[model samples]
Target: MKQICVFILVLALTSCEYFNAKKTTPEAILNEELQTFNWNDVDVYPTFSECDSIETKNGKTTCFTEVLTTHILEKLQKDSIVVTQDVTDTINLKFQVSETGILSLLNIDTDSLIMKEIPNIEALIYSSLDSLPKVFPAIKRGQQVKTEFELPVIIQAN
Candidate 1:
């Protein structure tokens, strides 16, 4: 009877250990959370005030791009920064729009010649962006989110 009781006790303890084993570790939990987060795309694109009336996604995006480009070109034209030589290059501008509709310049990639000709190019771009109306930030999973954009501005000197 003593041996049988001991065997039963061991079996019960082993069963409990198997049932109570840790199924999820901290690392596994973190990985699962990361998988659930969306990092590739947003639910909606950022928009300018003028684009608010637009209903379609493509239309809004087009309007935003057009308005920003127009504003930048107009500002540059007003500044009268003359390009001494005939050159063709593109300025790559990267910026972020915060959830509160504020614009933040991230980086600017342009030709060294352009930079040399227009030493205050960054200032001009920032000023132009400042003049723009507030923008509705991108949306992700029903929440407003900060978004980044890379715009290529083609510069052709005649």
Candidate 2:
């Protein structure tokens, strides 16, 4: 019994160094991971209910783009826009999707000529997106995160 006790004490003393080693905090690990991570890409793209069924990233992205473009076009058509002069412009629409799936416009880059032709283009785009269906926020690292996306909308008039 005495020999056994002495052996156990020696083992415990040697193992003390293992317990005293520095421990990393959760914040430190997260900061390091975030530093090395690519923020431009997401594990899963934001999805509309109609797009949730799609499994591939590109599929979901295509669906989302189609739905968004269709909605915007529909809104523009509903306005019965009639341009006096031929206008062709590609508007870069920048928007952010919240972690909770809400979408909001950040900026709209349109040619002055297009804006002059369709004065209410901004409002139309805003209303169309405001009425969009519920969205599922983008996923990053298994957590829902806000994401910004830019879509180019082409406007042409004869």
Best by lDDT: 2
Query: Compared with the true structure, what per-residue lDDT tens digits does model 2 show for residues 72-93?
Result: 8787777777889998889999
Q: List residue ranges in candidate 2 displaced over 4 A.
A: 1-28
Q: Find the candidate with the highest TM-score and give its number.
A: 2
Worst 10 residues of 2 by lDDT: 72-81
- Cand. 1 Cα-lDDT: 0.84
Tens-digit lDDT track of model 1 for 65-106 = 888888888877787777778767899999899998787889
Candidate 1 Cα misplacement greater than 4 A, ranges: 1-37
Clashes in each model (backbone N, CA, C under 3 Å)? 0, 0
RMSD of 2: 4.3
Ten-residue segment with the worst summed lDDT in candidate 1? 79-88
The lDDT of each candidate is 0.84, 0.89
